[model samples]
Target: MSAMQLDAPQVYDVIVVGGGNAALCAALSAHKAGATVVILEAASREERGGNSRFAGTAFRAPHQGLAHVKTVLCEQALEDAERCSMSPYTPEDYRNDLQSTSHGRNDPLMSEIMIQDAWETIEWMKDKGVRWETTLRKYYNIETQKGIIIDLMSGAPVKVVGDGEGLIRDLYNAVENASIPVRYDCPAHELLTSGDTVYGVRTRQTDKYVDFYGQVLLACGGFSANPAMRRQYLGEGWDLVPVRGTRHNTGTMLRRAVEAGARPVGHWGAAHASPQDIDAPLTGDITKTPVIPRYSYTYGISVNVEGKRFFDEGEAEFGLTYAKIGKMIGDQPRAIAYQIFDQKTIYLLQTRYSSGRPIVADTIRELATKLDVNPTVLERTVQEFNAACPGADIGHFDPHHLDGLCTSSSLAIPKSNWALRLERGPFVAYGVTCGITFTYGGIASDDKARVLNNEGKAMPGLYCAGEIAGGVFYHNYAGGAGLTKGAVFGRIAGREAALRAKGAGGEAARFRPCKMEAAISSRRTA
Candidate 1:
């Protein structure tokens, strides 16, 4: 799949850097808009798709209940359609969630574009052969005639059929079907620019430098995997945290974009970090399997190394507070924390924790000793927490919504919701730490997905999408928004760049063999 092996073109209309979802979407869209496109992926073919491959397969979108959701669903999902029920996620609901999570710090224009285009983009991807399914059936109450009624707080109801890997596979198939060539292991190192306009990219191919001339789209992702950048941008001890995504997203292209005069935007100190297994590897599975995240902390109490409850584990739903909790744990001693659960709330844990190795004990003291924390402090902490709980009754404990079952207000850090007394025997504990998914800081871009200079003007011939285009998120994030944001902006960048390249037609445009019409006219290789 190397570009050098093929009869390479002298130049293309669009050259997309990165092989993730955004880059694939851009390439597919640009090819549809009648442009010759090529993709430059930093990873080899086997390890391609960047962080998007490791991402959870869900997407948060504005839908008019299950009727609208069925429009983008696969045939398999449609079979069980009658058993599902979802309240309509209106445009206002989407807007408010974004604002509330980012604390109103998200770029208004970018947020607006995402909200407006989210559903349409999902439909577009579905038309391009992507299949979707509603996940987390347990979050819905399945006893009623309506079958499973979704929880409003669980914003992301739909996920791609095969998760992240399935998403990238479908998109890559679309790209190949459209005759767009993707060159793996060809990492773009420098932007080939003419003054303020980017014209191409210089990539490192094997042992030599190869230049691919075209309208450039940068979607190479954030620098969470880079230790120097993490420590420098995210502050102390960040470099030691586990990476939840690809190790190839080292910010080479992001730094290059900034060096080429693109303005940096968003919260540099914040990121999409979240809690995962303490034993999880730094770069996920060797086969690039998605890491099993432990987001069931909302049903339990999390304690620091000192055996004291540090923060409210149920301050909000897991979607809104997981990133904040991850950062909080990362700031704790040794960047470690343990989530304690009892028999009462153990069944409420999500299936994502099925692979976790929880330390089990019949008593609080035994559990503390197994966790390596001071038994006296841990026992006291559990006792104090138990005294604060309302009662041991599990009837009022609803896992779907914020049932106001909270700990006593007099406690130093009161549990806001789902507070159950940990008095049951056979207690369980799962050790956790921060897993950095992606950074929130990168080169700036406009609503149209055009790269912006320091003066806020759109730079000609340059565009960005995916995690590389920041400002949509800040301190917190809603689950599934990343995939939507990428698709919406990737399509936008692809179309805008293609139009510009078509309008700026020169000798490259006259070279018709690489064009869409020529590929269709000849024996198609895709």
Candidate 2:
């Protein structure tokens, strides 16, 4: 049996796989803990950051009030803070939201850790050079009568300065400042193990294979961008849905970990999905601000191809309901829908509406023609929706809160709240479809972010975090919770991996071929 060649003479204490917010957080934390760490990024420099780069940078953390959250805000955000109102987000609020959103199926221990450590992790990231701001523009309309109110009672009031891309830039800068080596275009294929303990990663650079021996931490993203995995796990039509993040997160590392005996958990059949502009790219562009989200559907009504209202457009606040709207839209006919709004609420749409071309018509018949729906059905649907409304004054319609003006319960699908009549013209509609952000199912890990085996035992020398660390969320997740969970567990995984590496006295100075490794290497070479 031939032994696999080591990549370099210097063995890193920790080998982090991925380059996005989670991976960077882990790498930074491990390095700060006095471990020699190296990051293996699948994407090149230009295409790094995983799903995090294209995400909205809102972070849902427990805070006292505006004063408490301002501790992590940047200079500019502080200057603009007085203009915005932020309701306090308590620990109980955070805990209940997580439990309720996951339908009480979330991992209890992991959820507790995230809930407790969320705020602290945000502060830690702030210390590491993350700039935050209280921006309601992404998820809320700014034209509210009470200036700009950010009601965190069920929303995320804060966001990164330049959004997700800005977050990646800051974290990358921190990684660089720490002098950690990040090997781009080097995607890890498998874990190198001796006995049941993973000690290194096997990656191919160009044509030849090379190995980096260390404590492996998989912060790589989920399988949203992998069409085959989507079909296999998330069901049939998921393969045709557009991705809202990086194309590099194809679940290679995740599959490798599972094949290596790590346990898979969470909602494999579910994901964090949202509505996107119909013409958006298959993989979202990170450089674009606001990306392709059309979350303002809460202020209007959506119809399927047959020109019929499907779900309650005003079911809940946009932040709480936006994530699941994509899945609902995907289940529609041809996986397409149109959000119709009148001049009364057209200006209430989020800024992301600028990315879409609105189909405008003086009448519902012409609009139905443009959307390729039945003209008569479209007109009737609108009339029924309008008739069901209580005819409340539009002036009392508060976009910041759930205004009690709902449609009559007698209708088949009543608009739950903020149900204003769509009477004024010219009416406008934006085409929409499902856009998947990340897969919820992934390798299961313990509270410390240590990977667990099928038997529910911790896998030695192996850790997982970020989207790859499953069970933190199930069917649905709160907005801004993704980044917060990633940061919290990523910090834990990094620190724990580093401490373990220190206990092991770092990586071995020389390579010795174990029977298992030798056999695997020989097969690969053949």
Candidate 3:
């Protein structure tokens, strides 16, 4: 028997699958571009806030000047990406980075499009009601001035705030004013495709299945919260790791896409480790203690299982640090490291660290005991660090005196007056666990944000943005770039998807599902 068809199809120009910044931008952009758009959000409108809303509202770029903005075009962005990328840079350097970071598994065409159009999208956002704060600096100065730095132009703001509620509120209000249909508590189960082209989406809502037809945008987010997908993509050990973002980002829609022949790209799970509560729930829990503030003037020095410091402690970018940390998991007992700090350090961190529980102890030994680490090792680590501070070098680990040393702890403070000792008792210790904010790896998309099939051709009526698009960066992520990429690319995808919908004709061939046995087996090795 033929499947029952709706006598009157509830048609739209496009259907957006997520409610985050990317999804919102895409839906709004498509609507403004003269397409009827509908947003199918898995959560209630009130609870629809995704990781974008909770982000540190900063937009990162290499060169900043209204005068030189044209010079810092797509080519310049691609070149800057190549300098820090892990893969051999290509003309499609951004796309290669996206795929290489995902271990050569993302859609290259989509990746290319997103990179190509990112700057224009940012400009469009500015044209629309988004305004960046003008007083921030765009660069970081390390000692000797030989380190990763983002060049900031004179009189230009380095970071921009989304007005948090204001940005989303405006988009939400605009979406409502447009009279776009939004189905809340409706979770898309799978894509209904007619061969190679997507036709619609099957959703599960209120214990009933509803089939909606239109071009679908899979913006449901990455699988950071799904334990099964986390284990499959990240690793088996990820079962113990806590998710630190929205719970609705379960990757359900992504699974459906993959099942329909959409190749996965950029699968590495990069995350932000919170020091407050170990393995805490993604939402809720604010602790009051002598712990360091969130995002304050703080630097990180990570130690391995051997209690030896590895990597530059001052590197503030969490994505870069997590890529390094992902290498050390299961290396030794505890498989953990303590973020060493004192009272002043606590105050500094209090300004930056957002949500996490903190542990307080009066001595290094006491702090070590509370964390179940070796007291002698911890003490020696502190002493050696302190002694090395005089020469601005911590044993083999060189200390670039960008920030002064820990002065409160005498055991760890350098002899130099410039160095601050970690002497004061009641030392604070926060358990640092590898927590993921979002997945960096995803399907590769072009500058236009079109999702390409395994053969590297754009799939008609299919588009993606946000964390779903891969190949923007390879190893390092400057703060605020992810959100910028998402918002920018989402607009690109929305506009292009609307164009495709308007021009589409005839039934496209259905996608044949790939053999997953091999992919699953390969995942085991990954």
Point to the candidate with the largest TM-score: 2
Model 3 ranges with Cα > 4 A deviation: 1-9, 62-120, 134-167, 268-276, 282-311, 315-336, 343-347, 353-363, 390-426, 473-476, 505-526
* Per-residue lDDT of candidate 1, residues 1-526 (tens digit): 3322222435888999999888888888898999889999999998898988888867888888877788788988886566656678888988998999999999999999999998889889999999987764433323332444444443676888777789889988888888788899888888866567777777876555666777899988989889999999999999988888888999999999999999999988889999888887887564433646888888889998889998888787787788777899998998899999988778777765667897999999988888889999998998899899898787888776788899997699999999989888799999998899999998899877999999999888899999999998999998888888988999999998899888989744543334423433342343
Q: Write one digit per residue (lDDT tens) for candidate 3, span 166-284.
A: 45665676677778778888888777665567777767755445666667787778876777777776665765665555678888877777777777666355433333334445442
- What is the clash count of model 2? 0
User: Candidate 2, residue 154: CA error in Å?
Assistant: 5.6
Residue 329 accuracy (lDDT) in model 1 = 91
Model 2 poorest 10 in a row by lDDT: 506-515
lDDT of 3 at 455: 77
Off by over 4 Å in 2: 1-10, 141-154, 506-525
Model 1 alpha-carbon miss at residue 328, Å: 0.8
Greater-lDDT candidate between 1 and 3: 1
Weakest ten-residue segment in model 1 by summed lDDT = 1-10
Query: Rank by lDDT, descending?
Result: 2, 1, 3
Clash count list over all predictions:
0, 0, 52
TM-score computed on alpha carbons, candidate 2: 0.95
User: If ranked by TM-score, best first, what sequence of candidates would result?
Assistant: 2, 1, 3
